[model samples]
Each structure stands twice: as structure tokens, then as C-alpha cells.
Target: MLTITDLSLQRGGVWLLQAVSLTVQPGQRVAIVGANGAGKSSLFQLLLGQLTPEQGSVALPGGCRIAHMAQEVKASDRSARDFVLDGDLDLRRMEAELADAEARGDDHAQARIHGELDIHEAWSASRRAETLLRGLGFSDYDIGRPVSAFSGGWRIRLNLAQALMRPSDLLLLDEPTNHLDLDACLWLENWLRRYPGTLLFISHDRDFMDRGATHLVHFDQQKLELYTGNYTAFEGQRSERLAQQQAGFERQQARIAEIQRFIDRFKAKATKARQAQSRVKALERMERIAPAHIDSPFSFEFPLSEKVSNPLLSIRNGQAGHGTAPILTGINLTLLPGSRIGLLGPNGAGKSTLMDGLRGEKTLLAGDRTCGEHLAIGYFAQHQLESLDLDASPFLHLQRLSPKASEQSIRNFLGGFDFHGDEALSAIRSFSGGEKARVALAIIAWQRPNLLLLDEPTNHLDLEMRQALTMALQNFEGAIVVVSHDRHLLRNTVDEFWLVNDGRVQEYEGDLEDYERWLADRRKDDTEAPRNNQVTSNGVPAEASAGEGVGESADDRKARKRAEAALRQKLSPYRKRQTGLEKEMDGLQQTLQTLEADLANPALYDADGQARLKELLGKQAEAKSRMEDIEAEWLEVSETVESLEAELAG
Candidate 1:
């Protein structure tokens, strides 16, 4: 359990979190939710003890251990297993001590060493580390890979795996799902559901929070507000609360008007002087509740310069892969104007290759790919940072992309995506992951292309930014070919899907979920359909997940079933735990509601009430601790069930 009292944090002389006091109870999953730059990350830093609050104290329960994971991870030369293996610092130290004792021929020391090994093994720490790594999308083969060889995104995944492996009583994570693909995110959700520790994390991914976090904490304007429920539930409750607050404000205004009337009527009368004076005092002392204002900054729209009646881009009898390694073959499809197409597939399924091919970057052998006239393309690659000149400022990137554009135009474009002032002038090499993403988007926006090819565009964007981007894209009158695993973004923005498997593209009629089912069905199909010559407007194969001569068998079928079932079972408790945590979080929020109400009373700011407020902070900490305990217990139960199931399967 951890407690914070009168915490205040400042960055560059501006208060980020002010007078913040809260508690995190064992076994509770708390989600920090807010718009970008609203102190959510700052709070996580405070909790991690990475940055000390300028004006308060954080107290952890005696003997409690803590682990923290940031939004971005940096790595040198190390494999995934090496990264996770480092998490067991205590184990390594203990082993070293035992080795030294054995070399000295101490029989008692050897016995003690054996006992220690037994205790460490009882925790199944090494096994758990392996499982966590696999869950985060690293294969067994990838376990020994040097960290220096991994792409930045994959390195982040490795960091996540390592963080998860760390043994601690309380775990704090900042945007843990930023780089995870669909499958990995699901696996993480399942793992966290059963983790036997207090959980607190900052994430912009609604699906991630919905799947795991029970309580939502909203940080804004240097203050923290608690909401009891998952993100969706919190939104509902917050809306209702806002409505009530508005109603209360209206009633108070009406009462004040009546009081003013009474004052006007009785001001000249000695008998009514007391009444008039009291009314005046009441008006002066009343603290009106302010309504919440929601604003979106993403508002750029594509200039509908031209329209194509047939497909904007078409492919016929297309085959794509490196050398003879065909990722997808016989691909045929047409991306019509105004169609929002989502590209869905597993990792290493050639989704990226297809996108690059569409952009005319990759050579497509055995396929006729054609682009419509007047097609101006804007691309957002997953490795966008790699594309940027590290030495240039974000403004410079925009300028390079649009040389004739005015300085004001560039700054305005940057500001729209939450980059402004000094941030725009910051070198691309020095920017944060999110900042770089914003800059990349700003560059794309300046070009104002009609055909948008987005590869995981939502990466590094906060929730508000994601929503804003979604809204902006919804209005664009152009073709959108997006490759992403974010279900929510796919559901909201995509009208159709192109599923790639085994060096082929399968066109689907509906959304990503439907495409996923179609892929699943293809896996279940008994008859291995021969490669048909018939191709659609776009040159893509109609089959699913077929690589050239990668034969399937009954064992593969059994394995697929097992994997799918395990995925569902792994996620089940986390889903249930998320629900339970939301309820508990809501209970704790009631205390905050009371505190806010008391604060609204002008009298509560007086000296006596200030002391009482500090006392109330203690109660909040207690509530936080209790919530954490529940989260830890939920994690234990979830993990226990998973371990038992794994044992039975073994």
C-alpha cells in the first residue's frame, strides 16, 4: 500500500499536480485518465518516486516493494529473456551468495542455499517471467535476441515484459499498452487481471482500461478527481454528476434572485435589517459550481480536390514478399474513393509490406497495381520516427514537407495536435514518443493529401488525441487505407477490411471483428482451396493465411483451438476483475464527492475546516489502501487459476 499527503509537483515553474493526496490500496486496479499534459504522467512519476513532490510526502507500507514502467522504453544490447532475467535481481544475488559459500566448503551454507532456491522456486518466478514475455508478443525464438537489434516499438514490448516480471507489492505503469498489438494487449489484460499486486497505470487506450482498471482517476487543472467505475462507467457517472451540478446551480441562482428581491424590499426597514444583512452575506459566501468544458483540437479536413468513381487504387494478381518468402499472394482488391479500409492480420502477416506496396515503395511481383489520377497520398508509417530527420525541429519537418507554407500556418498545424510554443521548436531527436508522433502527423496534415495510408497512426496518441483524430478522419472525403490492431479505432473509422494471410489478401464485407471471424473460419476450413486465378479489381488473392506450401495438419488445428481457448480463458478473470474494481473504485469516489461538497461551502476554507480537510486526506489514503489490497487479491486469484489450467494442460 502507498499513501501520498499534500503532494505538489512543479515542472518548469508551472504546477503540474497541486496539493494532491491519495492512497492506493493493495489489490485495486486504478487507472489515471485525462487529456494530454494534464498531469497524469506526472502523478505516475510521483508514485514511482522518480520525482519528489515539492510540497508533500509519500509513505509506503513497511516492507512493501514497488515497480514502475514508463510509456517509452530504451534498451541497449540485450535479449527479451535477458531483460526479464534482470528482474530477478534478488535471485541472482542469493545464488551468488550460495556459490561463494559452496566454494568455501560450508555445509550449513549449502543447506541454506538449497532452502532459498526452494523458496524462490515456489514463487515460480522464472516460469512466470517466461510466460509474461510470451504474453507481451515475444516468441521463444526471440527470447535470446539482443535488445540492440529490436526496433524501438519491439524494445518497448521487451521493457513491458521486464516490468511485468518484477516482483513487487505495488505496480505503477504509464501507458502500458501504447505499442501493443491486439493479441498482445489481450494477453496483457489477462495477465494483469490476475497479478498479485496493487495496480495503478496511466493509459489512453479505452479498451485496455476497460478490460482491467476498476477505478478511474481524472487529473486536470492541478487537481485530481476520482470516478468510481471503468472508463465507460465513469463517463456515464460524470455526465450525470455534471447534470446534477447544473441543476443545483440553477436552483441556487433562483434562490439568490429571491434573496436580492427581499433585500431590495427590506433595506429601508430597521425590523428587516438582520434579514437583509444575512442575505447579503449569503450571496457573498456562495461558491458556484463550474460546469466541465470538453473541447477537441483535432479538426483538420482533407480538401476534396478530386473524386474517382472506380477504386482509387486497384491491384490484380498481386504477390508480395521478400525474394521467395511469399507473405501474401494472389491479392486482388480495389480501394474506392471515400472508403475507410482497415487492414487486419497477425504479426508478421505482411500487413506492413502490403501498405508499403500500396504506397509504391515495395516491388509487387506478378501483380498489376494502378493508382487513380490526381491521387495525392499522405502516409503515416509505424516507424515514422525513423523517417524524420533527427536533427530537425518539428517545425522544420513541417517546413521541409511544405516549403511555401507560412510560419503561422506551421505553428497552427502543430498546435492542433497538442504541440505548441516551445514544443514546436524542439528537435525531433529530443522529442518524446508522443511528441514525435504529433510532429509526424503535423507534417502529413500540411500536405493535405486525399489518399491517407496510416499504419498504426494511433500509436503514442493519448485518448483525447485518438478521439480527435478519429473525428477528424471521419469527415475526410478520401480513401483511407489503415493498418492497425486497435479494435476501437478500427470499429469507429473502418467501413471494410483487407485481411492478409499466407501471401494473400481476403476482402471482407464488414468491420474488423467480422474479418477476424472470417480468418478464424479459414483456419477451420478442411479443404485447402487451390489458388484461384480469378482476381478482383485489386490484385490480391482471395484466400486467408496461406503461405506458399506451408502445409497444415490436425495438430495445427488442435493447437489453434487450444490457443484461442487459452486466450479467452486468460482474459476472462481480468474482465471480471475489471468490473469488480470499478465498483470498489466508485465507493472510494463517494468520499471525494463529499469532500468537494464540503469545499464548495465557503466556511470549509476557514482555519478550522482546513485542519479537517487534512484529516479527510487520511481517510482517502485508507480507502486507497483497501482498494489496492482487493486488486492484489484479484490478481492472485486470476494468476492461480491460470497456473492451475496451465498445469492441467501440461
Candidate 2:
């Protein structure tokens, strides 16, 4: 069991949590719910002994292994599978011992180690890690891809997979679904349900919390309160408590008002002066109950489109993809003024591809797409967050959309989205993912677009913001096409779902419940027919009769060798150029590091040291310049190499 006893945490001379005490039994799923900066993360740190609590103690069973998802992922060249496999420390240790035993020619020790590994079931660690990767929406090919090859969101998923690979007694997950697509979220829900360890996680997705957690711990008024049930039940309980508190506040206000009236009426009279003073004292001594603050910080709505065309956009027999590949073939879709559709599919099944096609950002491989002349688009994607001007304020971004709008009006509108005062005027370079997401959405809404193409718009948004968005969308008159993993948002906003599967898109007749059932049936079919022609998790043929650790036939081997030789012959120059660029960058980086070390010395500012400092700075600039050039060359070469490699592999 995990126990926190009268724990108090203070940061920056303020109490984030006070007199907080909670206990979580083993094998229990406890969700920590709170507003941002309410010390939920601080509590996790306290449990991990990363921070010393100002008061009380945290206790976990001795010898317990704890695992947590990392918020930041460093770029690396290591394969994704290897990174995930590295999480199993015990397996690695055993393997190391086995190698040592072999080197020492100790057959008995080697045999014993092998037996231990067998007992621990370490032999299938690679396969198990791969299984986890597949469940998390990684293709078999992606598992072998280098970490540097993935985007920030995908890298976060890699970190999650690594954490999940660990053998643990306690698991701590913080916003695990922030980067996940709908399919990945569904798979993760199933995975966490099967997790045997005690789980403590922080999430803003209410549905995910209700499904994943058995207990809810809410942070309010510098205090932690444990509730008996999931998030929904906690909300009900909290609402009732707030109602009672509001009643007490009203009574206190009324009593204070009565005392004030009496004091005002009697304080001027000679005989009642002393009595009035007593009444004043009583009013001052009265303990007050503060009213409940139930209103959400975020409250904004999309303005109705200027011209609501009968058909905002329409596509017929569309084939959408890049190059010669058709991700969504023979797709026919139409969006009218009130059209509201949610996209559902596994990752890489081309929901984003479909969105791009609809946005007119990508050229359709076949068929025609037509839109009304008055159609206006507001498109949102994770990548668009990157394209935001780091130096521009949210106010400026909105102004760019509607230059004629008054600054005060724009500021007032942005305040509803919680970008207040200096935050609204400051550059967004340092903003968090959620903040940037808000800015992007705000820009979209400012346009008053007739058609919205939202691809995973809820990625970094919190619960209140999500609720606000749901409400806004409910009232929106524009044609909406949104793809999100937040089921609550989907249930509340979208009226229909389009299932993208096997290079085709079609309307799914049923709701989310039926979709879940469909997934279950498909999974069952996958298990029963592991080698079907249909796409499975692996997307690879199941070679059942080929025996354990099957090898290719002689003819297959010869053909593979020929193909590899031909590809190498074709790609030799690009590979060599990449190698050359890497060497140059390595040397330049070393020189830069040496120069930076010299610049770090405090004495470099002295008059005598100024000359050497100037020289070193000059050299540093030169090295940096050279390094930039090398990096550009490397990027070109690397891209070329990757293109060739992909073609070869395909």
C-alpha cells in the first residue's frame, strides 16, 4: 500500500498543498484531479523522494519498483524497440550475468542464469515490447525506426511505451493520453485495465478517468479530498458539498447584513452607542464561508459563419494520399451547413490524410472535390502549433485574422479563453502545448470559418477547456469535422462518425458503444486468424508452417541478397555523403564545446583575459557557422538516404 501521512508541500513561499493525507491500497487505481498548479505533480514528486515535503511523510512498501512516463523525450539514434526493451532492468541484468558466465567458461553458472531468465520469462521480452508498441499504434517498421525520426508527440508515445515495459508494483502516469489518438486511447484503456499494479495518474480527460480509475482524489482549497468513486461520482459529491457551502455562505451574509443595519441605525443614538459597538464586534468576529467558484476559466464560442452555404464542401470518389499510395480510396463525403462528423480509425489509417484532403491542402490522387465559393476553412493540427510565430502575441495572431477589429475587443474576446493581461500580449514562444493549442483555436474561431477541419484538436486541452469547446461546438452553426480521442467531446459534439479502414471511408451507423463492440470482434478475428490477408497489428504475413525462428528458403535468400546489393549500389553516394556530414559536425561540435568551456570561466571578463576571450568568441562563432552549414548538408544527405532506404525497403 502507498500512504501519505499529513503531507504538506510549499513552493515559492506559498502552500500548494496543506495537511494532505491519503492512502492508496495495492492494485488500486487512484486518479489525482485538480486544476493546473494545484500540487498534484508535487505530490508525485514527494512520493518519488524528488522533493522534501515541508511537513509529514510519504511511505511506500520497501523493494517496490515504481515507473512513470517522462514528460520530455531527448532525441537519440537508438531504435524505438531497443529504448523500450531497456526498461526491463532485471532482464538486462540477467543477460549481462549470462554473458559473464559464458566468458568465464562456467557452464553451471550459465545454466543457472538461463533457468532464472526462464523463470522470469525474459526470453520473450523483445516480443512483449513489440506487442506493447503495436498496441500503442506503432507499426512493426516504426518499432525499428530511430528515435530522432519521430515527432515530439510520437516521441512522447515512445516514452510511454518504455515506462509500460518496466516491471513495477506502482505506476505513475501524468497525462498519458495527451499525445494519443482515439485508437491508441482505446488500446491504452484496455491495457491499463489489465495492469495489476497500483496506479496513480493525473488526467483532464473525464471519460478516461472514469474508465481507468477506481478512486478519485481532488485538490481544492490547498487540501486533498478522497472520494469513493470515479470522476463522475466525485463531481456529484463535490457539487453537493459546494451547494451546502453556498447555503452557509448565504446565511452568513444575511446575518452580517442584519448586524450592519442594526449598527447603522443605533450607533448615532446616545443610549444605544454601546450596544451598536457590541453588534459591530459580533459582525467582525463572525466566521465567513466563501461561495463556491464553479465557473470555468475558459468560456468562448465560435461565431456563426458569414455565409452558410447549402453544401460547404463535397468530395466524390476521392483517392487521397501522397505519391502513388492511396490512403483513403473511393471516399465520397459531403458537408452541409450543419454537418457534424467525427472521424474514427486506428493510427495511420489516414484520418489526418482525409482531413488534409478536405482542407484542400493536399491534391487528390483521383476524383474531384468542390466547395462553395463562400466556403471558409479553419483547420487545426498539432503541426500547426509549430508554425505559430514564436515572437507574436496571441492578440497579434488574432489581429492578423481580423485586422479591423478593435484591440480592446480582441483582448476582451481572448480573456474568455483565459489569456488575460500580459499573457495575451506576450510572445507565445514559451507557452505550453495547451496554451499554444488555445491560441491556435482562438485564431480559427476569429476567422468565423464556414468549415472546420480539426485533427486531434483536443490533444493538450484540459477538462474545463474541453467542456468549453464542447459547449461552443454544440452551438456552432458551421460544418464541423473533428478527430479527437476525448470520448466526452465526441459524445457531446459530433452527431455521426466516419470509420476510415482498409483504404476506404464510410459512415459508421452506430455510436461509440457499437464501435467498441466492433473493435472487440475485430480483435477476436485477429486472434483466430493471425495470418489473414486483412491488415493486422503487424501488417505482416503469419508464417505458421515455417517452424520456430523460421529461416527463408535458399531462393528467397538469394533474391534478398540481390535486392540488397542493388539498393546499396544505388544508395552508396547518399550514404557516403551523410557519413561525411556527420564527421564534420562531430569535429565542429567538439571545437565548439572547448570554446564554450573557455567562455564559461569567470576570469574571462577581466581586462587581461578580454583579448583571449575575444579570440575564443570569434572562433566559437566561426565553428557555429561551420556547424550550421554541416547540419544543413547533413539534413539533405540524411533525407536522401532515408528516401532511398524507404524505397529499398518497400
Candidate 3:
């Protein structure tokens, strides 16, 4: 379905791909894997025609349609469902033509357009769009919300939904699960498993690729090679290939040594001289196989804390949430020196709230929360990426942390995290998401904290970095609590599972496969009892319809109607505030992003840009402060709405 021949590409004067060629057959799911900046995304761009190769040809089967998700989505005022439905360009175009035909009284053209619309399934577009949204963890109410009303991560979800809604012969997704919770990721995996099209995606999640991809493409050494299985299988093949290459290299070196020995012992001899000269020429012409390069770019471990406490942190009868409302209650948890717990729950199920409660970012609404004197915290959250100083380099960030530490020691330490040489001293404003995440982890590792709270830490990490992080976590001598969609990380690093759901936290006794079964059973129960307090996280109904399905006896149905009406009446104000706050936050964040982008430019440091720079910096600070306030208000309103809704259901 897709073919590339003799592909050569360059970016910013650097060669990315040279003489690369690959073919993807129809109905095959291919995963492109590589280290950061190894041109995985560049390959996608080339396939999408956004980038023109220096010398190559890319061909797709004639008339084949393509669908892809953009890495960055701009803020927009369009409703989420409508934005997704717009992916079906044919449906929208046919509707427009049909309207024109009707206005001109052209019955024949109108009929033709109607047939096209039917073929496009235009009538069901909205339903399909909404289903995609719901499966991606958007609440039913969120379907009609404006695109600008969601955060950046949620906007990324909208982009994924949009791509999934489009009918195509091929689909390309880049890090599709980066922002998704595990529940949403699972739904996506199931959806892709049933997708009747060629699939190619860039994913850093090992377990996701293992479950979804049927083929692997590794971008390495300025070449692209195809393998015949999932990520794990690819690893096996790669390991064997490297072993063979190493064996060849060793054998060639031994042969060369033999040739050299013959040359040294038999040189200047009338008979042996001819043979020695031939051996030298043969050695010169022989192609050398490069040794297998298996070292990870990252190698760092969390330093042990200065002091240890048996139970570093404790919370009893804790009601945790923002403001006066509680999102999670009856929370009794204790963190010990060796605790390694992974938080598992559906989206909006208080996993992040638990992290915040543990981090003391959110105060307890009721009950007691305590900490040991040596309970140092190293919390890593997505928001911290934005909180980083764009003007400061990694070296400066660390230097600010520990002014007493020698620069050489710090640089050596940073080198382990792959921020070497100028990269260590360079501004981080233009760093990719993975680079920024590494910097955050580097700071946390340097802190030597006894307790760690990490939320979605692997969102933008690559596979190698994630493995390094897993190893680091395994060797750490601290209590760790993490909320991540990367199942591989959770399985390899964490020792216990804490399931947070239905406003409570409990220990789950099974592995990830068991959690999947639990989710499936919970979904079945939610379908049977749609309005119960035990809500299915993604709002999935029994059917794939956009709206709720009716399922109750006449008396029970009437009671539900009455209760829904009352709940709606009470929630009306909070919902309104919720929308308003979301819009306000989006606008503020957009403004902040613009300012940050402007501040990131090197020219902003010059004399001419100083005036403008100063103005933007001031505005940036104001926008950020307002963003925080709006977020706090939004959290309060959302918590109130959720609590009231749960109460109504109960």
C-alpha cells in the first residue's frame, strides 16, 4: 500500500535518511521505532508529503486515502465532536454540493450528491465522532464542549479522535497513547486491533506496541530496516543479528591478525613476499562490519537519601481534593522505605488526586495527613515541564539546585542523562518533550529524596530512556508511587498496585492482565446499570451510540428521569462555571504559550528585542498566574459537579 525507494532526506543541513527504502503491505500494522531524533517522525512527515526528500520516490496505491494525527493542535472554538467529524472531508464536501444542487433546482446533481453522502456514511458521522471521543475518555458532556475548552493534553486526545474517525486506507499516529490514561489506551488498542486499514505509528510505550503492532521498522545508522514481528520479537531478532555481526567482526579481526603475522614473518622472502602483498591488499578491500552499539544514551540512578524513615508518609481517614470538595475519600495509606506502588484507575478516577494528596499539593478536606521529618519529596508531573525556566540550561537548573557541587561533577552526572557538552549548557526552550522530561528526572534524581511521586512520567519518553528509567527505579532505595500508562514500566519497576476508583483506594491483588479483566467486567456492569455510582470511566454504553441507551423498568426509568432532572437543575450553575473556567484557562494558556515561544527565540536577547522581551515576560508571568487561579477555580467547580453527580447516582 505504501512504498519508498532510495529515500534520502536532510533537515537543518543534517542528513536524516540516506538510501532508505521500505514497503508496507496493505492490512499490516507497522510500528516505527528508534531513539530520539533518529528521524522516526521525519519519516512520517515524508510519508504524509509534508517533507520532500532530497532524492527518493514515495508511492501510495492510486486513490488510496490517508489519515494522520498532527503532533500539535492549535486551540480552536469549534465543538469537539464537530471538529472530529470534520475529518470526513468527503462528507462535508458532499453536503455542500448537495446544498448547491438543491438551490439551483438540479435534481440530478442533488441525487448524485445524496448517493455520495450515503456512500460516505455522512449521516452517522456525528455518532462515530462522539463514540471515538467517549472511547478516548471524554465524558458524554464533553462532546459538545469547544475545542478551546480543553487542556493541551485533552486537545491531543481530540486530534487522536479526529484521526480515528476518518475513513481511510491507511492511518498514521505518532505517540498516540502519550497523553492517554491506561483505560483510554486499552480502548484505543482494541479499536486499532479492529481497524481495517494499514497502520503505522510511533510509540514509546513498549507494551502498547507489543499488543498492537504486527511489524517493526527500526531507524538506525541512517538506514531503515524492517522486522517481522512486534517490539519484543524485534528485540530478539536485533539481538541475534548483533550477535552474528559481532561474531563476524571477531573472526575478521583474527584473520587480519593472521595476515599481519604472515607479513611480519615472511616479508622480503622471494616466495612468501608475493603472498604477503596479496594479503595486505585483500585486508584493505575487505568491508568491515561495525560492532553492535548497545549502550543506552541515558544511565543515571536516584541517589539514596541522607536519612531514612520506616514510614516516610502516612495518611489516615483522609479526604483529598481541591477546595472544600472531596474527589477521593476514606484514604488510608502509608509509604515505607521500600514501598513501590503503582496507581491504577480509569481517567478521572482520582489517581492524580492521590498523587497530589501525597505530594501535599492538595490539602485534605477532612482527616489527618502526616509525614516523617526526613520525608523529602521528589514529585514529577506534566505541569512541571511548563514550570521549567525556558531561559535556563540543564546545567544552570542543576547549578541553582546545588551551588556547592563542582561543575565537572554536575556535567559528568548530566552526561549520564545524555545532556552532554553544549547540550548541557544550552537553553531548554527548544528541547523536545523527551529531553524536557529527562531534565525533570535528572533534577529529581539529584535531590536524593526519600519518597517519589511521579504522574505520567513516560508520556514523551522514548523506549531506551524508559528502560533506563525502569532500571534506575528498580535500584532506587526510596519509596515510589507512580501513575503511568506505560505498563512495561509499571510491571518492571513497581512491586504493588493500588487501585483508585469510586472515591476510594484499595490494594489490587492481580497483575496487569487481571486489571484488564477487571476493567472489562466493570464495563459490563456499567452497561447493565448505566446510572450507578460505579461509573464506567469512559462513559461507554452497551451500544456504540453517542448518547445514553435506555435500560430500566418503567417505574425505575421514571425515578431515573426525576433524579436526573433534579441533578441537572442543581449542577447547572457549576457546569456553567466549569465551561467558563475552561475557556478562560485555554485562552490564558494560549497566550502564555505565545509568550513563551517569543521568549524562546535567540533574537529576544538582543538590544532591539529587549523592550519587547521585557513586555512579553511581564505578560507571561501575569498569564501564568491567572492560569493557575483559573485552574484552581475549575478544579473546585468540577469537584463539586462530580460529587453532586455521584450523590445523585447513589
TM-score of every candidate relative to the true structure:
0.68, 0.73, 0.74
lDDT of 2: 0.78
Expressed as tens digits, the lDDT of each residue in 31-75 for candidate 2 is 888877788888788778789988898888877788888888899
Q: Pick the candidate with the highest lDDT.
A: 3
Give the poorly placed runs of model 1, Cα more than 4 Å off. Answer: 70-78, 122-126, 240-293, 307-309, 390-415, 418-430, 508-650
Give candidate 3's whole-model lDDT. Answer: 0.79
Ten consecutive residues with minimal summed lDDT in candidate 1?
524-533
Comparing 1 and 2 on lDDT, the stronger one: 2
Q: Which tens-of-lDDT digit does each residue in 488-589 have in candidate 3?
A: 777656667899999999988776778998887765212211111111346332232233445757888677656765565566457557867876775676
Worst window of 10 by summed lDDT in candidate 2 = 525-534
What is the lDDT for 452 in model 3?
A: 87
How many Å off is the CA of 176 in candidate 2? Answer: 0.7
lDDT of each: 0.67, 0.78, 0.79
Candidate 1, residues 1-650, lDDT tens digits: the string is 76788888898888888888887677789998877777777776766667877899989876566777744556667556657767666667776886698799886675555545433442344456667776676765566567877877787777777677666777888778778876567667767887767889988787788779888888867887777778766766654566456664564465446445534543555643543454455335322211122344554544554544455788888877765456778888777777677787666778888887787765565589888886778899767677889888888887876789899988887777776788788877877777778777777767777788998888888776776676566566778989765666665555556667666788654544455455446432112211112223454332322322366687886686456455444443454465466446555566556655555666656887887777766776776788788778767766765665565344
Each prediction's number of clashing residue pairs? 40, 0, 0
Could you arrange the candidates by TM-score from highest to lowest?
Answer: 3, 2, 1
